[model samples]
Structures are given as structure tokens and as C-alpha cells.
Target: SDYSQEPPRHPSLLINSKVPFNAEPPRSALASSYVTPVDLFYKRNHGPIPVVDDIERYCVDICSLIGTPKKLYMRDVRMLPKYNVTATLQCAGNRRTAMSKTRKVRGVGWDVSAIGNAVWGGAKLADVLELIGIPKLTCSTQSGGKHVEFVSIDKCKEENGGPYKASIRLSQATNPEADVLLAYEMNGKPLNRDHGYPLRVIVPGVIGARSVKWLDSINIIAEECQGFFMQKDYKMFPPSVDWDNINWSTRRPQMDFPVQSVICSLEDVQSIKPGKVTISGYAVSGGGRGIERVDVSIDGGKTWLEASRSQKTGVPYIADHVSSDKWAWVLFEVTVDIPYSTEIVAKAVDSAANVQPENVQDIWNLRGILNTSWHRVQVRVGQ
Candidate 1:
């Protein structure tokens, strides 16, 4: 079936794009306070969504700058013990909308929901790398060598180009703590076409684009993949850079994502009964630091309070659940006594002591990449 044509509808967020992919539902749509359902998770695709059949026929090829190429068919790959992990896959451009507000940038205009956590089931990439002859290096030395590149079979009608490919540093590829995987299944079921049917790379702590879907090739290289996506796109630029003055080659690709968080509840102009109202959301830091805490402020950063991050105790509106690998996400909440007031604001921090930047202008780039800033929602307190 062409699942891409009939993408699943999600209730909790607003849809920003529909053809190439679907953005998250608006924060106001998150009625429930826990993990987002699999079907409802935001879908982001850059090309024609691929359809895969005959699992036995599926094959993944591994190559290197210095070694012989190796190929693994579906059966061969599945022979290895399967490992399951719940991880959050977030697009690098999750908050482009906020950045776009400061100045028009290129690419899909995503709101806060471009991220979703799911239980991924598959053979670990580390195991596959070992099978293909990656030497066992100490944890500290893993990042020392080169880069591990990934290519997708899913094709896009390039205005003028070849297939899509992306990669990450070898250090990131080999980190056991990163939990990179060749995910064949998502949320306990076979992957949907929109999400990469037969397989996709799941690089837990890197930008989502680096986790290429319809994964076909894995290469170990001494440098980042020189593909257009890596060489020319997804890079950060000074706030002073603009479309006309930009030099793409001078900037580096966004390999690791920055710490980011968002307020997923309450919408601008929404009204709530006066009294105690709870604010809740998710926070995560890329590159495997994990989120340590999320602070919430009701008065627009005038003061801050630690949002509850415990898994126990019924904190209404707070979703404190997290996955085992801690690669998924941290749901947090803070209850505030609202007098008949005018507006409310909230923000979060991660384990790296990285707090979301206060505004979009400071981090604006020509491509609108890496937009993690304080997410604020204005609401009215009713009498």
C-alpha cells in the first residue's frame, strides 16, 4: 500500500508539511501527558518515500576507504541477536518556524514536534561494524579515526542530482553509549514506508538526517561524506550571514545536534481556569549527554523552578517517563498557581548545562539549522 499517500494523522500537534513529510501537530494539540503514540509521531521525509517488499531480498552493503566491501542480506543480518531500544529521533530543523520568524531561511518550516520517541528493534550497528571488521578500540579512542557514512535507497527527484546520502563521524558511529542501530522495526512492528520500511540507521545522539532511511550503504571514511546534504546543507552560520553573502563551503556540516527543549502544552491565546495549572514538555541534548533537568518559568524568565522529572508520583500534566538508554527523551512538568493573569512562559535545560537560547535571532542561520531556543506560549487565565 502507498502508506506515504495516506500518512497517519496525529491529534496532539499541527501539521506543517504534507507531501515530502508531515511536521508535528501544534503544541496545543498534545492533550495527553505522556509518550507520543507511534502513528502520531511527526514524519519528516526529503524525497519519494520508498516501499520495500520481500524482506529476504533486502541487502545492506558495507564498504570502507581501506577494506574490501561486504554485503549482508536480510536473513544474514537478522541472524544476529536482535536488540531493542526506545530512542527519540528529532530532525535538526525541529524549530525552524521559530527561526523563520526572525528572518526567512531555507528548507521545511517545522514547529516543535519534529521529534518522536519510539521503541526501535534491530541489530546494533556496532555488532554489524564488528562483523565487517571494525577493530575493537577503547571507548576513549573510538572517535579518533574517521567517519562512518550512510546512504539511503529512497530516491528523490532531484532538480539536478543523484541519490541522497549523509554521514557522521566514526567516533559517533562507534560509541556504545550512542546506541546506533540498523533499525528494521519501530515501536515493535515492521517499519512503515514513510519511515523506511526494510531498514534505516538510528544514530541516537546525532542529527536525524544523518540517520538515513531506506539504508543501503555503510562506509567508513576518513572524512564526512562529501554529498550535497553534508557539504552544502545543514550547517550553522553567523547571524550576519544571509542568502546573498553566504559561502557554503566555508561552513561545516551539523554532525551533532545541540541541546534543545520545547513546551508541548498550552497554545497562544488559550484560556484556562484560574488556579493551579501544570506546564509540561520534553528536553534532550544530542551527542549523548542526556537531559539532567528542565526548568519552567511562568513569568517569562523572571524566575525559574525545577520541573518534576521523577517517574513516580501523579504529577498532573507532567510526563516523567524515560527510556532505558536515556537516548529517547525526558518529559517534565511544573505546576503554577495562575491568578487571573495575562501570559505565561516556559523553558528547559539539559545535562550538558546547555540551556535553550533565549531568542531565535542569536542562532539564526541561512539554512535555518539547529534552532533550539526558549519555547514560550502565551495563555490567558480565566476567572
Candidate 2:
């Protein structure tokens, strides 16, 4: 099975990159619900999708930097209990288009569609570690600082890179509260080819890069993952640092993202019916802090209307996430009159009260990783 072959994709997805296939659903299609449909979910592949037909040979080697290693087969992982987690996986570059407006930036110019929520089903990462007999934490001097490094099977083009990789604090990985999983299913269906068919890590509440697709192996390290994606990329740099004087090694990889929201119902310079119109979009925050409120202003922030939120309710497979601290995205709506052409604005606050920055220049960085600026769109009153 050649990994270079292109897989079938949903016709509705707006293609971004072709060879390595990156795409996202249209803005209107995303407002449909809290859980994005698997077919319509945004696909962000950095390299060729490895052909994975040989399930019997598909094994994940669990090695350690400071302890004994182990190899686990797919049979061993599947034998464990399955847990369904309703969580949102958002790319770090989800709103790069907005950031580009401030200044030119490098990397993929993704719009708002790079973020989506889905019900992921797999064995809890904590349970998997316990089954593998990872050493328990103790206050003794023998305690090795734990970092769970996930290595992806796909080859990437990053500097000093062979494969896409990432890692999170082992304490966070083993903590039941983190809700991490080696997810084999998305939206109740086996993962599609574009979404890591055989296996992928689902690191709820963090940037999408942390959830390595097409997972190949795991390693427990004493320090953070030294992979390219972990160190040189997916990090933010101050606006002052231009490409000529940029140092990729200076910054740390982004973990929990800042509060962010996007206006999905309307695009820039889109025409709309006269009088009152409904404005809708999706809002989400990282690190499981959850969204607090989304407010929309049609007249450049003079007056505001609170948007009604629609989060997932009573999905039998997912429990307790329906609350505020839930890890899923919240679809919001509000109606405002558009008597004449004017600027439409929206900003959201996460549960931690971190409000979305209104000005992109204030938060502008070199890579444009976290662009949570007040999402603005131009609407003209017309038929």
C-alpha cells in the first residue's frame, strides 16, 4: 500500500492544500451543531497519510528515556474499555487569516473552519498506562520527571524532522481529569483515512498538534519532546522578530490556547437581507476552561447583544461534559438589525475570563498561531 495515494474526501470540504490534503468545511456547514460531522471535519495533514492496512503488524512501541520499555499490540489496546469523550480539536493556526491582515506571516493561511468538535471514542490514556505497568509517582529521589512523547508515523518537512511528534506532561496525560485517549473512532465511526484511520491521540482541550495523527509509538521521557513540531514550530514569537532575525529555538511550544471565537454565519463583504438578521458562529477555549459568553456588536462595539449558546446535551456516550467546564465547542446565535452597511464584531470570554483581543496588532506574532482577535466581518444591507 503506497502512502502517496490520495484518499477520497467529502465534496463539501473547501480544499486548502492539495497534495498533503488540508481542508475545512464551509462556514455555514460548521454552524450545524456542537459535534462536527466526521466527513465535514477539518483535515490538516502535514505529510502523506501512511497506508495502514496491516492491522496485525500495527503495533505501538512504548519506550522510556529513564525506565524499561514495552511494546503493545492493537489487540492489547482494544481489549481495554472504551470511553467516549466529547471534545474539540482545533488547529493552532485556526484564525491565521485574521492575523495576516495585521501583517504578513508564514505558514498555512487557515480561516476559522480549522476548529471542530466531535465525540471521540477510545481507551483512556491513563488506563492504557496502568495496563502497561508504568511506574507510579512517588516522593522518593528515584522519581523521574515524566513527559509522554507521542511520535507520529507520517514524515514531515520541518527542520531536523523525520516524523511529526509532540508531547505533554505525563502528569497531565495520566490524570483522569485531562480525559486523554488513544482514539480509534470519531463521531461514533471508525476514523476516516484523512483523520488518522488506525489510531490517533486525542488530547482534549489543547491545540490540535498535541494530538498526533497516525500514531506510531510512545516514549516516556524525562524532558519535553525534542521533536521539530514540539520545539521549532507551533510556537508564538513577538511581532518585533522578523524572519531575518528570528530564532526558532527561543520560544516554547504552545500548550493550552487562549480564548477564541469566530463568526461563521457571515464572511467578509457578504451581502445580506435588509432589516434584522441572525448572526451565528462557534466559540471554544483551550485547556478545558470552556467558553463563558459570546457577544456580538453590529455597529462597531457601540451596543451589544448576548448570543444564545447551544452545547451538546444528553449524549448517552458522553457524560458530565454538558456543564460549563465541558471540552466541546459551543454553537452560538444572535439577531441584530442591519439597517445599513456597517461593521459586525464579536468577542468571547473563556471561563478564566480571558477575553478575546479586539485588535490583532496587539497580539500579533511571527507564526500567527493564536489569533483570537475580535472576529470582524463586513455586511451590506441588500436583497
Best by lDDT: 2
Model 2 poorest 10 in a row by lDDT: 134-143
Instruction: Give lDDT tens digits, candidate 1, residues 59-141.
Output: 88898655578998877768877988777778888888778888898888887778877788888777788777675432323
The number of residue pairs in model 2 that clash at the backbone is 0
| RMSD in Å for all candidates | 3.8, 2.7
Q: Compute the lDDT of residue 10 as modeled in candidate 1.
A: 49
Q: Write the per-residue lDDT of candidate 2 for residues 1-383, one digit (tens) a residue.
A: 23457688899898888866889999889987777898899999888888889989898888854446777778888898898998889999988877887798877878889988899988878787776565333111135757888998887777333788999988887887788899999989988778887899999889999999888898877788998888878888888887799898888889887888888889887898788788999888888877778899999878888887777455321213444437877788898778888899988887778898878998888888888889999988876
Pairs that clash in candidate 2: none
Which segments of model 2 are wrong by more than 4 Å? 1-3, 135-143, 159-161, 313-325
Q: How does each model score on TM-score?
A: 0.88, 0.93
Query: What is each predicted model's overall lDDT from 0 to 1?
Result: 0.73, 0.82
